[model samples]
Target: MLPAQICARNERAKAHSSRYNSKRMKVGTGRLRPHRSISAGHNRDDKRMKIGNKSGAVAFAVMFAILREFVMKFVSILLALPLTMAISACATTSTDASAPAAASMAGAKLMAGDGSARGTASVTEAADGLHVLVKAQGLTPGIHAVHVHMTGTCTTPDFASAGGHWNPTGRKHGMNNPAGMHMGDMPNMTVGPDGSGAIEYVIAGGTISGEATPLLDADGAAVVIHAQADDNMSDPAGNAGGRIACGVLAAG
Candidate 1:
């Protein structure tokens, strides 16, 4: 062969050999593991980060929901505790039939014209009218007239400031008169020799308040015991002499 032809053939063989080696290397590396680009590696990292973030969010949401549920239950328990205690206390408390019912009521402390203690009185509201109770002390042993008076004032001495009888109906005083009785008219109270007495009465169709003519109006009302007995047929006040004891009504 010529020298130039031999050299060209040898170069061609070297080039083919180089290409074959490169292809073999590629196939060998592919069998071992797939080759990755820089961008593909970055995409895998991004996907891992996204999964981590989603897992964290789900865990946080579950924790928060659990915390909220616990808080709600705790609050409900706290709110019910007082009511439970109150109900238990009420259940354990003793009740008496002689005790006054839980109703609208009022009370008053009586004082004589000389400012001495004269006992106490209470008025309880009922479906009918007012249930009046009076306990008296420091009085003479005799019969006396007890009546509801106009004003609450008890200006000492004769106690005339406790105006006239609480005659809201404007009828004649005594219970037996032809003109009939006043709303203030009540039965006579008997004072014992020990100077103490108690009387209970009910004023029909009367009210403590919230009416045009309630007993406890702006001017208020009072209980008065007179020196003399009511004859049951007298006008204005049944000739009940002077007011010996007076008490101002107060609401309870």
Candidate 2:
């Protein structure tokens, strides 16, 4: 080979090396290396595209965070709804538990000679007078006399501790007697075959308290049911037999 031919071959080899370096990635620091255009078509739009992608990512993150917060708050509210309703229900029940009844009255439980529960009685004050209600049980199916006695004390056994018919005004017993009806005088009670009896009567011009002739005095009052019926014209006793059931009236 000649010297000129060898120089031409070396020149071709150097040109091929330069072309290979141009196609490879550049690793030199920007400040240390001279500025050069990687491609003639490159523009400022590339920087804007990168910035737009970052902005889109930030916006998506912000929206996701807001949605997460909204979902958490909604779930919390749903969880608390039942607790709030339960608290309201408890408050309402407490209010109702404090209230019982709304009537001023008196009551008594009648007991027989053997101390067994026989009946119940109640006295309520109204505009007319003292309203009396008597419910008798465990009694024979027949007519019986029920009267308000003078004393509230109802001794066991005979129940003679309860005095005669209550007469605030001096008068004889029996509604049929002229100028004779006592304050304790009332109609006879007829028991049913089921051993139950009920009677309701309002004593005229009578009162439980705050009056001259109140049914309940310092010693209170007693309700007595006799075994036999009243003759309706009998004086003082009305021929009513032994006291079967007796109860002491108490204010409620």
- The lDDT per prediction is 0.87, 0.88
CA error at residue 207 for candidate 1, angstroms: 0.5
Q: Write the per-residue lDDT of candidate 2 for residues 1-252, one digit (tens) a residue.
A: 999999999999999999877665354454345444544225566877889999999999999999999999999999999999999999989988897543357788999999999999999989888899999999989999999998999899889998888999998778999978998988899999999999999988888876688777888889999998989788987898999999999888
- lDDT by residue (1-252, candidate 1, tens digit) is 999999999999999999999999999888766446667898999999999999999999999999999999999999999999998777656344445444368788888889998989899889988999999999999999998898988889888898988888788878899897888788899999999998999989888877655888889888999899999887778888988999999889
Best by lDDT: 2
Screening candidate 2 with a backbone cut-off below 3 angstroms (N, C-alpha, C), the clashing residue pairs are none
Error of 1 at 223 (Å): 0.5
Q: Which ten residues in a row have the lowest lDDT in candidate 2?
A: 32-41
Q: What does the lDDT read for residue 157 in candidate 2?
A: 89
Q: What is the lDDT of candidate 2?
A: 0.88
Q: Residue 88's C-alpha lDDT in candidate 1?
A: 79
> Highest TM-score among the candidates is held by which one?
1
Backbone clashes in model 1, listed as residue pairs: none
For candidate 1, the lDDT comes to 0.87
